[model samples]
Target: MGWQIAAASAVVVVLAGLTTLALSPLLGRGRPEHGGGPDRDDEILRSTLLVAGVIGVAIAGVAGFLIARRAVAPLGEALARQRRFVADAGHELRTPLTVMHTRAQLIARRMEPQDPALPAMRQLLDDSRVLGEIVDELLASAVLTADPGRGEPIEVRALLDEIARSMAVLAQAREVQISVAGPPGVWVTGSRVALRRALAALVDNALGHTPPGGWVQLAVDVRGEHVVLAVTDSGEGLAGLDPAELTRRFARGPRAADGPGGRRFGLGLALVQEVASAHGGTLTLGPAPTGGARAELVLPIRS
Candidate 1:
């Protein structure tokens, strides 16, 4: 609708300008002089109309732009609403999941070694913790999108240890060794929860791909002004796949089904990529020196 009005205004302005130009000579040649100039009433009228038309078209263009923006305002509001909902839902879920995980851990601790339900309790704890992390990742992503977020000095070595501990349940179940070997006292600046989520995703991906009796190692290094957290596995080394393609959503490797976890839906790498981007970092995928794949997340050293 706005476009139609603008087009019509443009056409009218052009016609008015042409009419004034084409009839000016004829108007000036006829009739007696009027004031200091020859009679040119019709020319003057057309010229005035041409100027008015130009002004009218300019006004219409501005109005059209406003109308176009107004028409899409609802879409902008809907997106904002969606972000708010995600943030709120993540906050609401965190408390209950935390309680469930704590209670499950307590019960598992109370059970004896021979207790029949101990394994189930431990598995429940693992499942609940994973779910809570999923929520945290989604929530933190949303919050960081809204605000780049404040930076905290996170010890890189400690962060790796935390991920190793959190992922131990899955690694143990799969019979894959999890090792964290990095120099201590190395620190970086970022959101702890988000960074942990990213590292956990990497470890989870490694554990899923590595066969039972294999191993995954998390290592840290300080190179120049950046800190690198690397996760290396002992599975088929990326199957010669493109690293960029792997980071894309729903992109699975050619041998996705060959791993212990079977075919993955492929959100893990994408999530890690998002976390890295939010923290002003980079996620790189490459073949390990020995075998299998290595995923490295690099971030700037705390300023």
Candidate 2:
């Protein structure tokens, strides 16, 4: 009777093992079975295969993730290096351009007003200045794009005021009324130089696009933990552009070339957007209340 009971228990164990093996293939939890599932050996093979499959899937996932990371790293590094190269090249080119401009200016001053060389010299000087402006813009853009992680605490009000004052001359030349209305001493965490450049670029854009006798207003207001700096130009506003598109690179609005001083517009606002982002800020463009376009730069306040 004891022998009979032992035999029955062994049969039950064998049947249970066979059931697991038979279901393994249907569940896709096993590797290739080397033998039929009716036997105990087949059951062991199925259990081993199931464990191996899980291990294989885990290994594949890890390998795939590593490959993806490796692929992205080089592209990011290349973009950074390219931006640095552009900045360096622009900086180096500025010196020679400045010398050429000076030489042209001197030639124009020395020549008689009616002389044929006078027009040529004047044109050269004008071209040189334009080239210099382009180089400055390129250098600024490259620097801003390459390093969005570089910013320090800055005083917003003073910076905007300073830029406003500096651009006052150009605004005057175009007979455009320019003003700044904002409180002082608002502190923000961003690269001071980059912040200044961003404000100047926006102000310049406004002054450029505002029709002669029109007004360009710059205002900075503290909204909770964010500082909002806005520049408005009273000229033909953006051509029904979606506000979101304004932040895109090279997205020049139709009004860009139509400002007070007959402005040559391209990439100015793009740089402003880039600078804002580099400082972990937001930029927006919309229609001003005075029937023109407005640009706003919102930056986080430094604690």
Candidate 3:
């Protein structure tokens, strides 16, 4: 609305200036040539036009503001409702998911090694864990939209180690090697949970695109005032891909079609981008020197 009003005022002012220019000659012609004194008629005309232009611009600006507000009012309300719905739904799902995960774990523990249902029970537990993680991510994304929370001193190297360990099983299953490398005790200022999630998303994305026998590396470093955490994979690089489009929600790259799961919803990078923004940081995607994709999350160091 403010932008619209400013634009409208600019247009009105320009038009009024043109109109005054056009009438200047006419006003001057009406002044008596024989008078050596100041031209009262021209002076009155200039003052009147100046006042009229100001008044016209004021009126146009007000009207533009009202119109723009009315146009966007419904859209604003709809977005607010949508955010609330997502946050509420995510909250409601957490408890049930926790219970399901707990039950699956208990059932797995009770099952004998030779039991026919042991494998199925294990799969159920894994599925439940994955679902729980998804729920947490969803909830975080929704809540972060309204409140990004506070920042605190975080051990960047420790966080990277944690992420690498958490993803080790998955990487091993895929025949991919995952490693974390960086100097210890490096610190940054941000929400640890949010940063952890963002880094996890980046690693998960790298692992998904990487093929068997490939390697994924998570490297952290302090460059001046920013702490940089990057994930590089020795898989197919981002050749012929639109990096900007991939960052958009639900947007997928070309490899998405042939992905192991058959076309992903492409929410990982989007979530990473959102988390980066929430921390006043940035996420960058590019081709890694290892002939694969590289994702970098750069954040400010603790002051």
Question: Could you say which candidate leads in lDDT?
Answer: 1
Order of the predicted models by lDDT, top scorer first: 1, 3, 2
- The 10-residue segment of model 2 with minimum total lDDT is 256-265
In model 1, the clashing pairs are: none
lDDT of 3 at 94: 88
Residue 248 error for model 2, in Å? 5.3
List TM-score per model, in order.
0.61, 0.59, 0.70
lDDT of 3 at 38: 64
Model 1, position 227: C-alpha lDDT score: 91
**Which candidate order results from sorting by TM-score in descending order?**
3, 1, 2
RMSD of each: 7.1, 12.7, 5.7
| Model 3 worst lDDT run, 10 consecutive residues | 256-265
The residue-by-residue lDDT of candidate 1 on 39-152, one tens digit each, is: 356556666666657766676677677777877899889978987999899999999999999999888889999999888888999899889977977786776666654566
Residue-level lDDT of model 3, residues 231-300, one tens digit each, is: 9999777766777878888887654546543223278788788788867789898888767888889987
lDDT per prediction? 0.81, 0.74, 0.79
* Model 3 vs truth, CA RMSD: 5.7
lDDT of 1 at 242: 80
Which regions of candidate 1 fall more than 4 Å away from where they truly are? 1-79, 95-126, 165-182, 207-215, 223-225, 259-265, 289-291
